[model samples]
Target: MDDVARLLKESWTLVEEHRDRLSGHFYARLFLLDPALRQLFPAEMTGQGDRILDAIVTAIQVVDDPESFEEYLRALGRDHRKYHVDAEHYATMGVALLDALRCTAGDGWNLTYDQAWRDAYGAISEKMLAGAAADGNPPFWHAEVLTHERYGQDTAVLTVRALQHPLPWRAGQYVSVEVPRHLPRVWRTYSVANAPNDDNVLEFHVRTPPGAGWVSGALVRRTKAGDLLRVAAPMGSMTVDRASERDILCVAGGVGLAPVKAMVEELTTWNRSRWVHVFYGARRAGDLYGLAGLRELMETHPWLSVTPACSEEPDFDGEHGDVSEVVARYGPWTNHDCYVSGSARMVRSTLRALAEDGVPPPHTRYDTFGDL
Candidate 1:
């Protein structure tokens, strides 16, 4: 497995630079092998290739760790259920993938790389298939948009109610959403901004900055109450550990507050002794859309505290600096369970600060919004 992992990573460098071409080859070959499979994907292929490549990179990186690898592949498999994929589709994808890799790698490709990927893909498919098979819930749930509220120009807080069936999920997990009215078959993942409830309502915080994010932009600007959406199965591991008694430290940036807020809401329900500190940051005070809610929560819960930070606004009150910097000043967080979520750069910086504070890897959990 280690040798396979090594070969996969080493071979990846040869083709990673030509990722766009590689993805093109992959989809072209995929459709050539099984033209019918093409219907499962969106009509527009924009940004689609990056998603698969990211998954492949994740799988390759974790191949040596059986437990993590299995968990990831399983979650991936279950997530793909939304596409109505089957075992035969995985086999076809494997063939298309290997062909693309070989063609893209050119002279750098070797028999060892080929065999390694074959072994790895087989394991990946098996676990994913097993995960899909084990799940009893529907592949995707039909949801009705109950409310939508915009913040400024690019951000929105929306609530939706799952229709017909309950969509079970943990506080910190995310689900893939397809707004068929705006972008059919184009799905985007969003963290559930609120804890699970019997009412089957889920809140999502979406930020569609200027031109990016088709689904997010639609949800924020074009969507409204009464619109129907398809919500896929939830996947993530950032949920709170009920067994742990450690004080909690949560660092959130921008819309990354979704999961952190959800987890904090969950904590409020049963927490009595543990102290939970949240450091929420944005570029300016105006961008701290969720700060008001967090402050309200803090006032009602004696164990909860929130420190809002503004990175670019010099005159704004409260902590002024990067949120991670603010966190560093407050830490020695070695004894606390830390959860950090935000843009990739923010999460990386905060994680670095936590590490510098001597917090163990197992004591920290994180999610990055860049990939979403």
Candidate 2:
């Protein structure tokens, strides 16, 4: 590899040992160097620390692959604009990031390593700046929650209307959400659950999972109509490649069904020749919140078939098993394009099943942040 890639690998390994402090140290340095940035982030630095470190780790993974790296960096930059990130903050942030690396690398840090980090950060900064400038897109969209309907104690369907701006997004992309009431500045990404509409209304299906109650609870339980929220730029690679004429197999687990639902909506509008089979699963029957919508799509689109599966509650189910297992039972999907979303474990399981059933890696699509 390249010097930047190799040096990053070395630096990353060392940094991982100090993972708990990496973001904290970096943010500390960032605020100290430029105190103005402190207002841009969340008041509670709880999960924020891990996010910065995760972003860095994600960047290092694809730096050797220029095309993948460029797309990721560009999307990352555009997403940062939601936080009011400016061109100048990049320099301060880069310096703080390098300081974190230097602290983590400690005795191992050298002139060569220093040069590599500078080069890497420089490249990252340049792409982010270019991404932020390439399209005159707004920093973030202001949306009002028109409806927050809860299907169960945990799941809610939110309809949000963007004000005076169009947030154009491809089916299957996701956007970050920030609740000003519950915890300002702390954001979580959620998939758009329906295809675009003239009403400028977007649907989001949210479920409050364990340990995610803070944000999810706010979204599903406390959020009410007329409540204001900030929506970040849409970014994802799992979107439909309309050019692909292959049949589709969509596997979704729990809230993973959100993006899959959007894809299905889009598919219904496309030429009906291509067939699609959707297998959606949840832990319990109550968690399978969108069966009514799926059924409606199936009735309207002759080429579409939906199978709702569940791992629990066997008494009155259509399909009974883990969704990955259910997908494998129906597969030999070598000729079909496969898309999977869900919890990290579920996504990994589904991919493994798809692989075992002869799906090619190239034919399987998911968001880079599929697990997150």
Best candidate, TM-score: 1
> Native-vs-model 1 lDDT?
0.93
lDDT assessment of candidate 2? 0.86
* Candidate 2: regions farther than 4 A off: 368-372
TM-score of 1: 0.98
Error of 1 at 50 (Å): 0.8
lDDT of 1 by residue, 1-372 (tens): 788888888999999899998999999999999999989999999999998998999898888888989998999888999999999999999999999999998998999899988998999999999999999989999999999999998899999999999999999999999999889989988999999999999999999886677999899999999999999999988999999999999999999999999999998899999999999999989999999899989999999999999999999989999999999999799999999999999999999999999999999999999832
Q: What does candidate 2's lDDT look like per residue over 206-313, in tens digits?
A: 877556736777998899999999898998889888899999999888788888999998877765788899998887787888888899888878899999887888
TM-scores of the models, in the order given: 0.98, 0.95
Candidate 1 collision pairs? none
Pairs with steric clashes in candidate 2: none
lDDT of 1 at 81: 95
